[model samples]
Target: MSDHLVKVSDLQIGFKNEEGELIPAVRGLSFTLGREKLGIVGESGSGKSLTGRALLGVLPPNAVVSASHLSFENTDLLTAPSAELRKLRGLKMGMILQDPKYSLNPIMKVGNQIIEAIQVSNKISKAKAKKAVFDILEAVKIRDVKRVYKQYPHEVSGGMAQRIMIAMMLVRKPDLLIADEPTSALDVTVQESVLDILDNLVDERNMGLIFISHDLNLVSRFCDRVLVMYSGQVVEELVASKLHDAKHPYTRGLINCMPTLNGSLEPLPVLKRDPSWLGAAQIGSGK
Candidate 1:
């Protein structure tokens, strides 16, 4: 066991292409996490989602995964049993998917879903689970828990539904919360509210957070550390507050492309990636 709650080393994911050749999604990726926010920022095709799925042990069947070391606390998640991973996902490690509409069951009562998630993880009584769910809703700044609990998924607003998802995940008080584009589906204001809820939850719970998104600007503001990926490889790693001080060409391009205070877009900077930075040679560790 170490102070790090999650440690991924030399992790790799590949799948057979049409030509029957293996295509790597995430290659030789590595990192460490604890009680802090870690942001994974890259474009759509940069394998960011696959990286999060890998940690959850929920990769698609076509994918092949191998890692030198993938440990959570003292347990090696890469080889842990399905039952063990289930327990972790339930109580100790929770993940927030990109969309609550897809992740949550449409037919089930929203309240029941949250209660079921918490009850299964904690194996608590009905009364206890109900109380935990209500408290979690309040934590996320969702008012009128009684009404929210009675409503179905389709019955609630998108913002409230997202809050329910957050409440469901947080009820267990997980040590690590992996959010994969948690706000991508919401409107601008709802998105901010969701991010605010996440910020408050992470701070109050003292839990580790891994926020995966394409918006470098958002990640820079939300996290303490940033891992900048380009075409499935980490091009640079920097403290979030110092992202503007990044030295890597790819990282710099990302920063320059962000809309500025002046809001001038006469000629936005385009990323000029060095071909050498793409090959396996430079896919080396950011550590």
Candidate 2:
């Protein structure tokens, strides 16, 4: 068996305009993921979210996706049938979306939703599924598991709702997990708690994590390696600890654009856009 859990090569995603011309959103993105945390950092519309959605085969109907190779645990994602892909989605791979309010069903109780997910992927009875749900909720550090189980989505706080979302995805014990800005909506303390849960779970399960976010500092502290994207293409890759030493001008510009706690009272640096950076994709050694 290969060491890589997910493999994507020369992946391109686009859409057709009124003129039927292909307008690319993700251009030739390639990388391999093992049982490790890999962070993709870039601004909005840089195809960070699209890349994660594409892997789950959840792109919009109008999307035009093509890739030289896209596979999950040796399963050919590009050619997999809808039934196969559907089965793979929650059973072997799970995705934690950015916001729980938008992702969860407003009418359903939280426990029932997670129980439904558990039952869908496994042939367990409701009793067993409920037990699994509670276990996962506790695993994610939800103290009042019983109360949370009966409460509706809106009844819980944003942080608790996000934890519920995490519990739902993790109940299945997937091999690959995609977290699209899971902590983006939480406050600092809650965000730290969420990250701690994710870090512990990933380490304990040996799951491959694709953490998509625009926060370079958070990614550097949490992930093992980083992929810096620009205009739908990867301009640089770096070891997370070495992100500050990024070679690509775009990466450096992004770092410089961040406001420091004690920064000088000057305007933040504006990134100078260069058309040449969008040429051929640059693959870094990630040293």
lDDT per model, in order?
A: 0.83, 0.90
Count of backbone clashes, every candidate in sequence? 0, 0
Which candidate's lDDT is highest?
A: 2
lDDT of 2: 0.90
lDDT of 1: 0.83
Clashing pairs in 2: none
Tens digit per residue, CA lDDT, model 1, 10-101 = 88899999999999888888888888899999888888889888888888999999999998888899888999998787778888887888
Give the lowest summed-lDDT range of ten residues in model 2: 278-287
What is the clash tally of candidate 2? Answer: 0
Provide the lDDT at 54 for model 1.
Answer: 88
Residue runs of model 2 more than 4 Å from their true location after superposition: 284-287
Q: Give residue 270's lDDT in candidate 2 (0 to 100).
A: 92
Model 1, runs deviating above 4 Å? 187-193, 280-287
